[model samples]
Target: MQRDKLITAEVADLLRPWFSDVTVGAQPVIGDAPAVLEQPDHAVTLTWRVGSDDPHDIVIMGPRTQARYHLERPGRDCLQLRFRPGRAADFLGRPLRDLADRAVDAADLGSKSLTAVVQTIADGGALAASQSHAARLRSLAEAIPVAPPTHTDRAALHRRIVAEATALLSIGDGPTHEPVHRVARRLSVSERHLRTVFADRVGLTPSRFVRIDRVRAVLARIQQKLPEVSSRAGYYDQSHMTAEFRNVMGTTPDAFARRRWPTIEACTAGNG
Candidate 1:
């Protein structure tokens, strides 16, 4: 049952602190879909491929620092749960660094709650086209065990610092060009400590996170000229911007401008 609505508000709110988004879709992929430029993400994602006969395709993707070029083929009906930065460890009971840049079978993580949810969805035949998103989410919400309170006072404070620092470094309301050292200073921590905590909780160094965020900001300037984008994205010059763009996105701005690549949604359909 192709669900025409988003995840249920009740379940969404229940998981809002841990997850940034929950999406359900079944986009079709043609013979040769355009490659997708998946930018570095600070959060982890769990993707489930439903709507198939023995539908149990579940993958848990961790935080990524490098750019990836993915080719999509065939069609898919999938539900993705995107965790908020630095929050997956609380729910998954593991350090984010261990899972960085890797996509593993969800079962391998050994989360009983996760396994139960997957089994329930598969047994119930919750195809994206057939089952309502509300019902599917209800199943998930019911199956997910409450996260254990394992964090000590100090550990809890460290997580808070990482979350705050992540917000400052990401492409958000504040000035995106803030240097790592400045961010550390503002957060009342040493730059080295900040880097260490970020690598442990966010799976990326502070400088690398800022670099990826800058590229994302530039890409968001879809209506601006190349020079304007370069300047506004805080690059030293157009040449610098081009180099960063190519390094992070694997394409020059000119080529990207000529042929607008599809969004990540299109590439997410295929298992590749």
Candidate 2:
């Protein structure tokens, strides 16, 4: 199917920085390919196939620490909502640590807002395709709550630390990125304290977050050569980049660059 890339101004204003992308009509393209080894994602995702045939297919996927191997069936029209790093806690209204590397039924999260949005999709069914992409996104945007709940002093402190830490970790000087201890020091908190808060909010440790962020950076620039991509992505060398890719992506950089992965058009400017 031909894809449309457009974001209505109203939806864009509402979902910025918190929700990063809304992928409509996404289906994997696999031909004699082994199980796709997906890298760790910092954003928690809500995914459900379109149409009433699978109304109950809604899933809430938490941030992953390790790589996962899964065979995605072709020809399934999937819609996904990807929340920015550490921002899903506000919308989902729960700690993410328990959800690390897990995929659960949307009902399990007890998020009324997400459930309502899913209902809208279910009601729209195949007719949703006839509407403009911007119109559909506006509908979903309207159903979602923009404001986060109130937090106590300590909870607020943790949220602040996690937010700053995620931004710093997402952009670092080397392969190790910002050391956990150093980041803690900058935030005026103990290393252990930062780790605990980060895990609670992001569902992954600071180091793991850095690793995944680096891989994601590399993934975004698959058109470049290994040497250039490695250096730009803060890897020690091409070999180091390949090894890290193997560990987190379950495939070498060269091989992955050649594969026919699904197209993901970002709907917002926020990289988180």
Candidate 3:
């Protein structure tokens, strides 16, 4: 498969108010994989399954919060627009919470125009065989009506806060855990309000999201053959770590390490 990661330089300043870097990726074919990485919340993915002539081309794969997932490789080539957390709701015109942990066609969500645009990208990824998918995607993002924030819009502010909350919750080798109340106070919202907004816009509640992200961190370490152990990821002990993996990833760490899972990547959650 031909793989390319393109910069969103043209729209970076324009999208900063509401998104992270508008990175674009294009590929000629998707190879089969047995497992998909359990990533932190992903932005909305706009996919164009190449070789498929269906007008409804753009498929939105929502964010996930898990240790791993069984993989299902796509049959065709496509370009993807990974929309950052807290921002997809505006482009989608709906609460992202309702669409969590699933892939829905743009047409199904009343995203007819986007579906059409994705078809264009699919054509771009396939027919524009001459043009790079990244180039095609950059041109495509320019066509969307994602207006930059003009002032301190409350909704815009809310999106920013919720996005930050997701980042803060993606704890690393820090204190293992921080009180949600502290973060809520820092964001100037009540804990309950933060939970509501986070779930509605970011897919998972703060605590659950934190737990899962921490597990992902540990999994990454084990996969890398690093000296780090699960307990270093804030688990109580080796047994606690093993049990967490069995319950969350459905396997033990030793079993998980033998498999291949690319970082910042995805696949179906299959048995390792």
Candidate 4:
């Protein structure tokens, strides 16, 4: 995989504390790497993607009201800071779920505040002060009531869910045709337990997440110019690949290649 580049001062500042040792750089999507939809997590991200004729290519992804899928397309680059769930709500003064599943223009956030926040982090601001700000934000965010799972009391439950999902996502090139019993046996968990865990945490069944992961891998392969991308991504054939592509991306793979690839390329380049 190509290394992710972080260029903007704001993005650098926000992420430097956590990913200080990692290098950030630009990525170019030259071929079929359509931006895949990601499952929601409890994190806040501030991202900017450069555009062609447009200023940014952004979309919101997720079922929640505040979660969004933002993409910088046509190979435009982007810089983003992924924040913990509560932290985003605290900093933004609203539930992130309010923005879910819809794309909003970044210009909506008012450039001044965004710039200031970005610059503060980039300047190597004191961690103690940042923590204080984060606490203040959380206190304010507590007033809003969002319905997604807020707490997981069972450490074992959380581990089981994450581990099962990881294993499912690591399956071979195609969607799993094997029954849940087979997978459960491999993981040493009952099928029922696996299903419940995934539904509770990810809002999707284990099978669905596997399909999404496979589709994403397929998209990545297409971008890399691999011969027979379908086979490479674990699809049984081109037809299987097409079906999975439409299921997740809402368009045929070819259309995505023609229409969306350029935008993705732009986002990767501009963000880096």
Candidate 5:
């Protein structure tokens, strides 16, 4: 079947220093077949979409693994934003570990500030709920809540560390197996500090995040039919890749390799 692309706008330039991308647009989706909910593999996402029951606004999707779940409503438009790893700290105003694998109702990220706007939509005021989804999100960016510099040296250091760590982990297209010690040494911080910042900021132990990234990376390569997916993508070998893949993805690499993912492919940008 031919692939369909959801419209994606790079609103990253608009929300700097906190959000990496804001994806606003809807795509045509056919009804979906039941499928395993792929583990939490994408970047931290803020999503608003039309649903079977009603509209879902201010849903915060964190990072972690899970079992079966359904996709978003078919034949409906979805709006979403993805935060750069470790960058969600200020906007979310909390540790990410608390929300992993859950799409909990969001209160932060300037959601409270948009209450009047959303309430108006709910009450059939200025805009319908459908129009409100994207507009409210854009309002979120325009709000651009900047905190007064009340943080101590320690807080600023932590942000810098997490930001650098996020960049380090993101290098080379996928996750790295480089020793945490080496990474810490390169970043000029101790391993203990590195792990703490990762947990507090990006919401995973450094090792666990790396493993998830490796598995997700290899799967992306497999999906694209890229060569040497295992080795080139940083797994020690095929066995290593398969074990990690099955652990996070709940399916074997070969199973994913041979299968077509029309539903998964339909809306791509928000996955980060």
Candidate 6:
């Protein structure tokens, strides 16, 4: 697969202060590759990948639960906008699961007009501008109509959930140390409630999120040339790491360290 590049827009600079070092650009995704799921630290993303041969590539919203499939061609590019959990939920107006596992065509998803959304948000007129990209997204959102439950007060709920999740992520190896209960306590909610919220907004539970986070953290450490990647990532031992690797990634850590490491590493290094 070709390395993905960030498609920078004029308005991207506005997001810079928040994302700081993260890269919020676009890259092309080619043919289908293996499925790799990720649990991101900050935002959920709206993603589009176009291939050279096929005009109708996939367009997806990569919530926490969804596995982002790898691209076969290096030339395939993607456009990604990362958002905080609450903002993401508000923007999408629905639980992430509603969009999962379904193959959506680029045309149906309005691929040609995406730049308008970028332009709108960049101009600081996301909610105000009638002709702006943000407005266009709202319009599209209206047409698609995937907004979250009306009674849930999605924005407030998302804020609370994200805060708790972030706090849990701050503690290294959260998943390994009774992750489910720890996260539930941090949120001042029961484990069942936490799972429900996460599933509703992110399409996954807290436990699964922790598992994915752990795998990504270990892989990141290894890429940085850190010694004992497993230990540093809070794995009790190599065996423990291997078990996690199998559970989350469906592969051995060594295989990931050798083959698929760069894609995620690049994503981590470049995510804005």
Q: What RMSD does each model have against the real structure? A: 4.8, 6.5, 6.0, 10.5, 6.5, 9.3
Candidate No. with top TM-score: 1
lDDT of 5 by residue, 87-114 (tens): 6665666667666666665434344433
What's the residue-level lDDT of 45 in candidate 4? 47
TM-score of each: 0.80, 0.79, 0.72, 0.47, 0.72, 0.58
Q: Which candidate number maximizes lDDT?
A: 2
List residue ranges in candidate 6 displaced over 4 A.
Answer: 1-13, 16-43, 49-58, 64-71, 100-154, 170-178, 223-227, 260-272
Clashes of each: 4, 0, 9, 47, 0, 26
Query: Which candidate do you rate higher for TM-score, 1 or 3?
Result: 1
Those runs of model 3 whose alpha carbons end farther than 4 Å from true positions after fitting are: 1-5, 8-43, 51-53, 66-75, 112-116, 119-127, 146-152, 172-177, 224-227, 260-272
Cα lDDT tens digits, model 2, 108-223, are: 66777767777677677323557665676677677677755556887677778887888777744444456677888999998888888888888888888878888877776766
**Total colliding residue pairs, candidate 3:** 9
Q: Rank the candidates by lDDT, best first.
A: 2, 1, 3, 5, 6, 4
Task: lDDT winner between 4 and 5, please give it.
Answer: 5
TM-score computed on alpha carbons, candidate 3: 0.72
Report, for every candidate in turn, its global Cα lDDT versus the true structure.
0.68, 0.69, 0.59, 0.43, 0.57, 0.47
Candidate 4 residue runs with Cα over 4 Å from true position? 1-28, 31-153, 171-180, 223-227, 260-272
Error of 6 at 40 (Å): 8.7
Please report how far candidate 6 places residue 66 from its true position, in Å: 7.9
Question: How much is the lDDT of residue 175 in candidate 1?
Answer: 37
Q: Write the per-residue lDDT of candidate 6 for residues 1-272, one digit (tens) a residue.
A: 11123323323343432222222233212123243334333245554332112223323444433234343334434444455444444444456555433434333444333334433333443334234343333333333223323445756766567556755654354334446777678667887877777767665566666666677676556454433777667667878888876665555667655555334322321111
lDDT of 1 at 4: 31
Better of 4 and 6 by lDDT: 6
Looking at model 5, the pairs that clash are none
